[model samples]
Target: MIRLALIGIGTGHPDHLTLAAIKAMNAADLILLPRKGDAKSDLLDLRRTICAEILTGPTHVAEFDMPERAATLPYLDAVDAWHDAIAAIWMREIGRHLPDGGSVALLVWGDPSLYDSSLRIAARLGSVAIHVVPGITSIQALTAAHGICLNELARPVLITTGRQLRERGWPDEADSVVVMLDGGCAFQGLAADGMSIWWGAYLAMPQQVLIRGPLATAGPEIMARRAELRQAHGWIMDTYLLRRERAAISRDAPTS
Candidate 1:
């Protein structure tokens, strides 16, 4: 049986790796990196940089072209199909590199438990022994970069995707919400009153950028900046946390 290690690398930053993640990389018989054309080649480059910096001794490395998703399908359907395709690709790669059933590792961006699909794809391999090495997540890096807590003290924090934020608006139960995979500027849909936002792009990386203010005041600025950066880099990964301040009651109130 092929031993698969799903190692989280975290937000395109080499320093975000934990000691366990590094050790997993070194122990792997094969390390597979996915290439998504030139525009996103920086992603694979980051993976390679981590290996060069951390991995010692001779270990096999494989790079494979990533499959493109069908754009005609609806978003969820498209992503589902894409994940299926990726699983197939992964099986092929593993078969070629580990015909004898040895340990293989794939470097994932951010923690696999988040919005990432590596875990789901691995399940498709059918009864393989899977190990996970957790790394720093973008949410953690985003919060730390902005020097803010993830939630109001004693309050619940909701972690969600950009699509959910756009469709459902801000959740009623969560005073604090962390948004990820937000390519559509979902924060703009929120009612800004009493709300504060802490935003970061490329968190924990050299090109890191950050913004924070009342959502009403900073929403437009963040939108504009996000667009500019997306144009410059051809891709962007960003995350943010939003919280609402408690509203004050009227001075003249009826006593019970």
Candidate 2:
């Protein structure tokens, strides 16, 4: 039986790695890292740094080229095909390294239970024992960096994606919303009359940036900064929390 460990390595920070993740790395017979091309070379470099700093044992580290998703197909179909291709590459690499099957580990960004896809890809392996070592999520990192609580007392928090917010606008009864995987600043179009926002990019990294205030005043600044950062870095990952003020909620409510 093959033992597969999906260890969460939070965003690209060395400090983001948990002790369990470190232990898992040393215990692995093989580890896989994916290179997403030169535009994201910093990502590959971070993984290499983690391996160099944490791998105390004789574990074989392998790097593979990440497969590109077909952009011409419909979104879901493209994703499905891409996942299948990734799974095939994974199995091929694992087979080439461990012909008889052994323990393998891979670094996943943030908690695998969150928005990550490593666990989904691992499911394709079939019949393999899986272990998940949790790491700090982007939500945690974002909130901590801004020195704020995720939700107000007795309020529900909704975690969603940029596409959902862009298409549906804000959800009803959502006291607080955290948007991840947002390529665009979807919160800019939100009803910003009485909302507060906390936005962060590259959380916990040296180049991290943060902005927080009343949404009306902060939204444009956020968009401008986000665009600048993306242009400067060639890529960007950002998340934001939008909280409705009590007065705004009361005013937005319908009367009988």
lDDT against the true structure, each candidate: 0.87, 0.90
Over 3-79, each residue of candidate 2 has an lDDT whose tens digit, in order, gives: 99999999779899988999999999999999998878878888999999999889999999999999899988998
Question: Across residues 61-148, which tens digit of lDDT does each residue of candidate 1 receive?
Answer: 9999999999999988998899999999999999998888899999989988888899988898897899999878998898888877
Q: Clashes in candidate 1: how many?
A: 0
**TM-score of each model, in listed order:** 0.94, 0.97
- Residue 23 of candidate 1: its Cα lDDT? 89
Q: Where in model 2 is the C-alpha error above 4 Å?
A: none
RMSD of each: 3.2, 1.1
Q: Weakest 10 consecutive residues, lDDT, candidate 2?
A: 184-193
